[model samples]
Target: MASPDTRTQLLDAAERLFAERGYRGTSVRAITDLAGANLAAVAYHFGSKAELLAAVARRVIEPINAAQCAGLDRLLARTPDPPVAELVAAFVGPMYDEMRAGDEGGARTSRLIVTILSDPAEEVRSWTGPAEDAVRDRYLEAFTRALPDLPPQELWFRIRGILAVTAVDRVEVHNRLAGLPPVAGEAAKQWAITFLAAAMSAPPTGT
Candidate 1:
């Protein structure tokens, strides 16, 4: 049996390399080499490379999802209906906190998450779908309550936009925006929350 420390080492190495090279681009040999473990270690701990990728994604995503859900729970307890801005913050804040912590593994994991979410590949989706879908459904319920007047199609569109913004913020792309002043750290998060809140609350245009 792999020790807990050995398992962590493998996961950390896999996350970093997967972030840098992508799931298809990375191989078991490289992951074990970086992890300083033998070839058997990956199979011993995670069963396969695909499993390792899922584990790495879960390591980061589960915690963030938990935090977001907890925040939402608290807000809902205090008031059954919270403002859209507060709802947006409850969803986006935990992720921004992780990015701001300057944890190298976290940043890499966030990048990997973006890649996995964007990829059209079925294998990756199968691994990530359950956890991602649960988190998404929870937030969708809250947003639906907050914007009861929004047409279902429009609400889904806004939700997708908010998710896209969250993913972009996680990758820290605000710095790369040409002709726009660089915004980093908390400023970027604040901007995203405010922008998304407005988008969510916008009066529906009949089209």
Candidate 2:
């Protein structure tokens, strides 16, 4: 097999470290050391550590975003007004599928996404860009169609809330922290999907 180029090596290293230690915990030197490249390589290729992180986030997130959008599109094509549970499954299922079937690198990318979603560091939090906005808009549109009675602000709030909950559960469930039994494989995926669907379908508050 052909060897990975320097940029690819740097991205690989950044993804691993960002996923494992988070962006704040990882340093440019650590990434270079893991990639077997010199420190200047990151600057040369990505411009800065922040840019490298943005690139890593794009690589990890774009494919999954596409999958999610496509899934929702297919559902809408078949059923213009799909049920809430189906919409949730279409939108949220791809990440779980990736977690279940992707290789080790892919799994790390999934964790990296969850880390990015939950990371409190200002730099990490600010990394989201137009691509993510587009995905969010696409999903929001589909969900709006599914739940027209849901006030727009409430819908957006619930969506963000469930996403935060889901991110936490994905990490905590996978790590089996506090000696809690890990819910693995398909069961865990279903649990997450069901929880999200229920939250999305919940009656609007203050009705």
Most accurate candidate by TM-score: 1
Instruction: Count the clashes in each prediction.
Output: 0, 0
Off by over 4 Å in 1: 1-4, 99-102, 129-132, 170-183
Q: How well is each residue in 1-207 modelled by candidate 1, as lDDT tens digits? A: 456487888988887887777788889999999988999989988888888888887777777878887898899899988989999998888877765443552456567778778777777756655766787788888888988888888889988898788775545555565676544567767887889888888988777
Residue 20 error, candidate 2, Å: 1.4
lDDT tens digits, residues 52-147, model 2? 998988776777678887887798799778888987887677766754444452346556878887777776767667867887787888789888
Candidate 1: residue 71 lDDT (0-100): 91
Q: Ten-residue segment with the worst summed lDDT in candidate 1?
A: 99-108
Error of 1 at 140 (Å): 1.6
Best candidate according to lDDT: 1
Question: Which residue pairs in candidate 2 have backbone atoms (N, alpha carbon, C) closer than 3 angstroms, thus clashing?
Answer: none
By summed lDDT, the worst window of 10 consecutive residues in model 2 runs over: 98-107
What's the lDDT of the predicted structure labeled candidate 2? 0.77
TM for every model, in the order presented, reads 0.86, 0.85
